[model samples]
Target: MAKLVERRPLKAWERLNILAFLKGMRTTLRWLLKRPITLEYPEARPYIPDNYRGTPTLVKDIYGREKCVACQLCEHICPAKAIRITPGPAPEGFSHIGRAPAIFQIDRSRCIHCGLCEEVCPEEAIVLQKEYSFSGTDRNAMMIDKEELYEAGGTLPDKYFKWGKSE
Candidate 1:
């Protein structure tokens, strides 16, 4: 006696497709006559949703100071280690000044924009902003410096958590 091999049955939806094909055709025809939803490049631009992560924004602290204490928290948090900071001296009247970074840089060539730096920053010195319309001519120009990042980024909130004001 020969034994028959059993096979799994086809899905119910796939078993019957004549009506489905007609419905799909009708939908396609309706779409064909409708207005085009795509925007033409070099002439038109699409809308980006709010809170979209586009660029890394640098923020300052209260008293018109830099929020970063140069603790190297963000640098350590960055998986790519794209962040570089060099410490500097602090102004007078503060004997307990912590490490102050004179050189802060973020290499766009390697940055993943994971927002880890922002989340790990004890001072919230950085944030992912909505500035997505950035373009560069060369690799050298893409490496953002401290002053440039601060200038390009939006102003930090008037009072951050460190300043004792609630969000």
Candidate 2:
């Protein structure tokens, strides 16, 4: 057998929702007095995860030779038209197989960070790096050239794991 339960009727003041509004205001005020979680930039750098794709960089072969064949695949595949490469034959005494780029430039302003250029690179020359803190006074300064790319890419300890590859 079940016991009979008595139900209490809501008062007019309770039905007005004043109590609910006061509870919400109390929660908001409590949060307002808390410290901010934001860090001071320039003095502090944010943590970057391993899979972060910040900047597109060029990589070198194990022998310190430029891995790019100057094939222009990355340039053609870039949807933003940010990549530009001037192809030229390798020097007479060079052991490299493919033509080298006379002028390779990446306009950071136009790059969309889609990683399409890195995906299409047959030689695996281009890779998305973990560097995001970048600033320039002028547009031309943001346009990264071959030398800068080489410097940034060469120092990387590991090559970017190709996307869609089985571990």
Candidate 3:
């Protein structure tokens, strides 16, 4: 029977070179010389882009009606299932069974902040606010319901996109 030999571990000098600290120190020095990329983020707000997509806000018409047609197109378009909608009653005094969302909620915790919902809305019922700071103390506080979303939603001005027209 032949005896098997175990190989010894390589010495530190013989080991492959990896710059873990040197590169980090270099980056730190560069950053120290340059202006900070961020300030007191939570306290100090920063400027936002015109097409910035932060949180989903629900829109309503001047006629006191929700802009959402309850088409479920936004729900279908969302990559993250952050939006929750339940069917609601039709327009009052009208026999036609039109659709409305009984419960329209957006879970900020699960949202990716993608603008797909805004893009897919036929009636332009949903939009992302210029406001980016979404910090909250409670878990439920982050979950914006219909009323809260509506309140957060600023005026529906004409949207201007650099790439294309704001639909």
Candidate 4:
């Protein structure tokens, strides 16, 4: 058996729930009066920090020669295994006469942008640029060859190479 206790009814003001509605409206109005921070993308490019990392590239020496010795360190260290290289003797007339890569390729689709290849490169042949916008219709189009890497790296500034040592 249970007792049936009677309780008082709710007040009329409490039943309307006006406070919650007013708070919501106030928030909406406050936001409506604020200005947006968006920019016209094509006309004005967004600010990229100095330390920002975008795409990995293969750099060259000051003498306009390929810097990579084809050590395959980057290929072995890449977590995504996006890098592939074929080792060969250095090009004719090259002063270094060291081992170079006959074939160097990287699959952008498989790259995770971890920056490990650049960090581990002893010859400082690989570096990451600030280029962020790139599009490809097909998966194979995303693959980058040795020539493409050289082009993407562009010309390294004199300051980048100091005391015959690349930075």
Question: lDDT values of the candidates?
Answer: 0.76, 0.81, 0.76, 0.85
User: Which pairs, if any, clash in model 4?
Assistant: none
Could you tell me the C-alpha RMSD of candidate 4 in Å? 4.3
Model 4 Cα lDDT, one tens digit per residue, 1-167: 99998987868876787887889999989988888567888678889986677888998876788888899999999999999999989999875748899999998988888999988887778888888777799989999999999999976766555346643
Every model's TM-score: 0.66, 0.70, 0.64, 0.75
| Candidate 3: tens digits of C-alpha lDDT, residues 79-120 | 998888887876675343377778888889878989999988
Candidate 1 lDDT score at position 77:
86
Local accuracy of candidate 1 as per-residue lDDT tens digits, 1-167: 99999998888877888778999999999999999998897478777676577778787654556666788888888998889988777645434446567898988877887889888877777888766666678878778998987887646666445546443
The alpha-carbon lDDT assigned to residue 143 of candidate 3 equals 87
Q: How much lDDT does candidate 3 score?
A: 0.76
Q: Would you list the clashing residue pairs of candidate 1?
A: none
Q: Clashing residue pairs in candidate 2, if any?
A: none
The deviation in Å at residue 81 for candidate 3 is 0.6
Give the per-residue lDDT of model 2 (tens digit) for 39-129: 8986987788976888899987666666677999999999999999998776555564557777899999888789998889877788888
2 against 3, candidate with superior TM-score = 2
In model 2, the worst 10-residue window by lDDT is: 158-167
